[model samples]
Target: MLPNVTVNPAAEKFMRRMVRFSGHGDGAGFRLTVSAGGCSGYSAEFTVEGAPLAGDEVLAVGDLKVFLPAESRLMLDGVTIDFSDTPTASGLTFFNPNAGACGCSSSSGTSAQPPGVAKVDISSIRRN
Candidate 1:
């Protein structure tokens, strides 16, 4: 069991929309993982999958789907996903409760992830 994080209204609505809009016919939706890196050491990872492994949690919101990998779930059991649109384009933001004691830092100091969830693709795709 992982620590639970509070979900903001904006994040809940955005997550529901993203899952509904993903257009993936496959049963799987989003896979949340944790990986090494970040100033604190570990971060969370999110991905789309066709299926979820045992121990994974399937969360649904308004036809939207989000999956938490078994191992990753330990670190992000109760986190919330939020959406924000500033002068910049709209994007997903994570509000993780298991961040470092001091607090995880994003480029904008808005999003955060927990320790050890194997953030495979996200880190490679985006250079921090």
Candidate 2:
């Protein structure tokens, strides 16, 4: 059974390091949310979470906890969050199987469907 959203070992390790450096106690975790903006038509935002939200689905990877809202579950299903520490770039990158034309990160999971492709009003999607 695949999880709604999964975290890689590297991400968990990175989160551990972040908690140690941030001076937050063991209760520190991450909040995952989707907003309408990124080039892919949606954006993924991560914030520090002191506690779980009222109705979020929490995924525990190692000792780290990731909070995902109910609305974001479908878009994030089967997604894997990984961390990298290369000298040039160091951050968490999301690997979404449903991704399309992703410049950075997305929650829609794909490029905005063309006007003719679907009835979707691409213009209605605001830009950031």
Who wins the lDDT comparison? Answer: 2
Residues 20-98 of candidate 1 have per-residue lDDT tens digits of: 5556555746665654456544466555566666777776654545666656556555555555566534455555555
RMSD of each: 6.2, 9.2
Superposition error at 40 for model 1 (Å): 5.1
Evaluate model 1: give its TM-score: 0.54
Per-residue lDDT of 68 in model 2: 72
Clash-forming residue pairs, model 1: 5-78, 11-82, 33-117, 34-117, 34-118, 35-117, 35-118, 35-119
The number of clashing residue pairs in model 1 is 8
127 Cα displacement, candidate 1 (Å): 18
Model 1 off-target regions past 4 Å? 1-3, 26-28, 40-42, 61-63, 96-128
Native-to-model Cα distance after best TM-score fit, residue 71 in candidate 2, in Å: 3.1
> Model 2: which ten-residue window has the lowest total lDDT?
114-123
Q: Which ten-residue region of model 1 has the weakest summed lDDT?
A: 119-128
